[model samples]
Target: MRIETALAAVAVFSLGLSSADAETPFKLGTFERNGRTFPGLVLEDRWVVDIAAANARLQKQHPSWKALAIPAGMKELIERYDGGLRERLHAIANEPGAATPRVDTYEVKALRVRPPVPDPETMVNAAVNYVEHGAEVAGGTQAPTPSPTMAPSVPGLWERPANDIRWTPYLFLKARSALIGAGEAIRIPPGRDKIDWECELAVIVGRRASRVSVGQAREHIFGYTLEDDVSDRGGRGDARHGSDWLVGKSHDTFAPVGPFIVPKEFVPDPQALAIRFALSGKVMQDSSTARMTHTVDELLQYASNILTLRPGDVISTGSPAGVGFTRNPPVFMKPGDVAACTIERIGTLTNPVAAGP
Candidate 1:
């Protein structure tokens, strides 16, 4: 809600890139942070360089469309429009004054990215979504007895004002203000070590939805992208896990998002996909979405049943196995480290760990 207030603080940001200068839609381009080289989609076909800017342009272009009173259904219409969304984006690529600062451009060049829908009003994370991860951490059959310490506890205990070590979703807000883009550098917090990474897919809500049925949950999702749920394992063993998690996970640049947002239409099935993480060129985690005990739809439906899902809300589906906490001596991120999370279909997100002063 303070978004309007924040944007108002800036009169204009300068970008030295020229517009296409014709009635062409901008192509979809993948971007990287800090000028790093990486793979990206160069779709000259059509796409909006910036959703907010395009909306303003659309209002000026066809007054008739305005009378139609269509909200920001551009994403939906783009999927079904004449040439489809990409095609339409290309058509208006050169629209005057509809361009955004190139500095914020999602280009292939090095630059930071944040959750497209940063500052999600509500956030939820699934627990034990990955069966194998659950098995590895809990050790089943062979170690039938539940680790008394591993049982789910009250939520928001990971890192909160108070701490409860009991296991649960242990959810907390990373503060929308703290989100940074993929390829951005993450500052290792002072007085903290044992850094950990949890690779998970994030879902963005399309509209104001509540009590959305499991069958209709897909309708609620606008798209999906990659997010690395970086953690502070040193904060473990606290009584109030949620409070601790809030602090541990809310450190600046803890949540890295984006490479390109693959809309839900592109991913008909959120399950049956593979997710992984690589740190400093070493494979740290590899698991399938199929391993999640609760599917995306299920997680959405479950969370909505409890609260209204507003547009831009985020749900971090649970992570797979191989967390640093479970290692022999435990493996945590150190200064000058590079970490990446790759989800099948969704592009991989990589970030560098810079030591704190």
Candidate 2:
């Protein structure tokens, strides 16, 4: 579909409404059935419509129209998203019995719900981006005292805002191979105890971005999804090199992302959502994105200045306080435990913990 047509369709479907509106319909994700993966539209009662198949049918019906050719995969859709594809999707969703056998649809419970972007180029994560989380992880202590009688600080000598006690959005890279979808197992590697859960709001990059300013960062975001930044607290580096995030954070199935990816247009404010997670039906981390010290735009701007962010790159915008490692006596996820992370507007991403080989 033409980009303008697609955009107009989304406008008609959403009526320029925010996701918080009760009338907003449909969320997006990827699903697997019989070993075949396709983009899907999440429906009521754990059912989903295979959009790729639906688009194929639409194309066959309208051979003369060139605009019916929608992107086949999530990454392509995001990378090329203009208004046309979204509008086409809205039309497909509005079709009567679209989720019925006429279109390829399946009960989500009977199939696998994979990560929205199954293969991102890079997954960048923000560390301690929330004030309370930074304090909690630092044992709620104050910064060390500066030497008494020190000379008055010069501009270069004085710490910049980015380098001061106020935590900047410290970014780290996670292995894309570690990603798993909702309902998948987060296998706890043997001998690595203290596996903790961090429910974070993850942003999916829609376009190529490099050195974008904070004001322009929002323009490059395609959508928002939930991510559980699973960590092995015991694997952190000791007194020498400090915490080894790669070893602690990058394990197979360490990043359990998505139940769905809500389009950025649907989510009006990325920093105002309520985020929470539970372990085995017991609520653990419960907070709002409002508590974040550095907003999603700031984090994106910071990271883009350092390196290029291509389409399908994921930026995990940090978790709130209440992580297990910061708790008294430390609590961790054990095998057989279920971890569920939820964000308002965005859905819940639940994964079961299993013993690794």
The numbered model that scores best in lDDT is: 2
1-357 per-residue lDDT for model 2 (tens digits) = 444444545444443333233233677888788888877887653668888777777667656434555566788888766646766666566655665654477778877888988889889999888777777887875423235444332332122343334433578999988999988999999889889999999999988999787789988988899899999888554666876888889999999989888878668898899999899999998899998877898888888877899888899999898899878788999998999999998888989899994
- How many clashes does each candidate structure show, in the order listed? 46, 5
lDDT of 1 by residue, 1-357 (tens): 233222222211112223322222222223334554322222232222443345445656555432222224333332333223332343334333444334223434433344454446666666556766776667552212334555343342222122333233323455564577766777788878877888999887766678776789887776777778777767646576343656667677777776556656457588978888999989989988887666787677767767788766778898888888888788888888999899876677888998863
What TM-score against the true fold does each predicted structure earn?
Answer: 0.66, 0.86
lDDT per model vs. reference: 0.60, 0.79
Q: How displaced is residue 54 in candidate 2, in Å?
A: 1.6
Candidate 1's C-alpha runs over 4 A off are: 1-106, 110-112, 139-173, 236-243
